[model samples]
Target: MSKILNEFLSSNLQELKDNGLYNEINVVRGANGPVIDIDGKELINLSSNNYLGLATDETLKQAAKDTIDSHGVGAGAVRTINGTLDVHVELEETLAEFKGTEAAVAFQSGFNCNMAAIQAVMNKEDAILSDELNHASIIDGCRLSRAKIIRVNHSDMDDLRQKAKEATESGQYKKVMYITDGVFSMDGDVAKLPEIVEIAKEFDLITYVDDAHGSGVMGKGAGTVKHFGLEKEVDIQMGTLSKAIGVVGGYIAGTKELADYLKVAARPFLFSTSLTPGDTKAINEAVKMLMASTELHDQLWENGDYLKKGLKSLGFNIGNSETPITPCIIGDEKTTQAFSKRLMEEGVYAKSIVFPTVPRGTGRVRNMPTAAHTKEMLDEALEIYEKVGKELNVIS
Candidate 1:
């Protein structure tokens, strides 16, 4: 490599190491379940996004296996060309129904949905009022759209209203839109969608919700929008098939017009290879299961409440999360990393998250208690947490 490139890489790498911002990847030896094997050690896994534990469901697995045998693996090409398989059409239909929308379009991944849908709708001539703490995918999608982005404070309806008024009345843009995550992953706070929709109605602004972390976790598995009964009010709803759906892909659910427009305009759907048949089939089955019952969803909440109560009682700052995603806040970055390391050593596998993912000095070890996690597993994990916390002087 050239001298400049080497210097740039060396300095950045050293800085991350010095600041406790460097992420160490752990390899899961088997299926990512409530308990996972890492480095020959059995650990109570609390770092996954599998809220309902459908990722390892035998039903989903069987669906994928069956489809792979019948349709082969890949979708063969991009959807616009020849990849619009029968399963693809079926999955989108299921997704649209799940979202309570008129139509839906699937993408290869959740990240791609934002990258495609945002730019396809908004442009430089428009302005996007986004939540200050939205996922990075939303941030990047806004930038790619070339729209004037105005940041609204986290869940602050007043701030959203003020920004909405300014953007819509400024006359500096042709159209304005408000976008936010249905659930903020880091803090696990639900967005104030009702108030946001009210504001949008007042200003005639478009509304979009990136429900990547909410689907199958909120709205009795329908999503946050449905959770609030705003399915018909919200214009665009984007969700992941991977997270709670327990598969691999994303979708944009909205009116038939929006879906039709995106089918023609979204570059990722035009260029990238489509989601494989197996994943599509599996995702379809998963959604169907959720519609059939809320057994997993109820169990997930039970585990989350148990874990949060345990941590809070132990004197850890378990933030004001309203979802199964819990964060044990340890302010200092280095200490947070050390805390997580100690937890790992004691048989729990919660990982530390620091700068960039969350604000500086608010580093945390995010714990995801899923439906697959038993009361016994949570009790064991909590016990380990208490021991680690006291040992590390994180709790009295």
Candidate 2:
């Protein structure tokens, strides 16, 4: 708009382009299932977070459509302003039951859930000990809380223990909290919850675990907190209905007092419009599915293992991943982007992660294998991977 603003944007744009950091957005034309259509080409979609492939499930779709018929569309107002629908109450109850918590409160999205819950609990007089590799939402939440942030090494229990001990012994804050992702998204590593819980017990620090990527993928789909049997120990359990739940919302599961406090004090909950009735109903159905069976979860893991083995056999570095998320480490940013482009040309759509999304020189092509993927589909994708890997010199 303004000349100065235009110049500023141009400068940054040129810098990104010169450094091979600029990214081009692609239009996904069809449903984001195990396979997706991008630019009129079908591809084995390996870039989605839909771990269980429930996003397009008939059950969830029907539930959403049925709810829409009964409750119209939007929530009309914020939760505090008479916008809380019966579906919202039902979803919250379902979430609480799923997470084995006394109460649960839902938000518009996972990012906002972190922003709301963290600030509602921690304050200026408090201190936070966080994992270095925690999700961006956790970082923003800690920052929003205005707590003295102390970053511990990623998944390093020793560092966490030391920091927790120091923060508590200093007596410089009224309260201290240790926060981490239940599963690190990029690297596909699980958090050391058992050790973290022990440290929290020792220091009496409030515990927070953001299970955005862990819900419906861990604990037979209950989440990482349940995976580690720390359901009651972890003070705050944050998760998303967007990922594995195949809906659009986030929630905080904890004690009744904590949920009550968030409902009253969290700015997003108090000011933002509540989730749609369709989303609420769909998420309730998703949770019920997970509670009833583990078919999808098992299928997802099998697909992940198959893809990882296939990639590894082709001489591509799949990185150290213990979950369904697989990353083919390509190192340089340009090479990573180029490889992703080549894969797209071959009708395999996998996104490249570089720089800001990951650390420098650690760029990768992350793959998410969902339950809906058939064995034949994965085998075909692996053949494409082999061709691309060889062409790009990523494999011999």
Best by lDDT: 1
Q: Residue-wise lDDT of candidate 1 within 180-299, one digit each (tens)? A: 999999988899889889999999989999999999999999999999999999999999999888888999999999999999999999999999999999999999999999999988
Alpha-carbon deviation at 96 in model 2, angstroms: 0.8
Which tens-of-lDDT digit does each residue in 1-396 have in candidate 2? 999999999999999888778998999897899889887789989999989988999999999999999998888899988899999999999999999999999999999999999998899999999999888899999999999999999989888888988999998999999999998899998998998899899999999999999999999999999998999899999999999988788999999999999989999999999999998999999999999999999999999999999998889888889899999999999999999999999978899999888999999999999999999989989999999898989999
Q: Assess the local accuracy of residue 189 in candidate 1 as a C-alpha lDDT between 0 and 100.
A: 89
Clashing pairs in 2: none
Please, what is the TM-score per model?
0.99, 0.99
**Runs in model 2 lying further than 4 Å from the true structure:** none
Give the Cα-based TM-score of candidate 1 against the true structure.
0.99
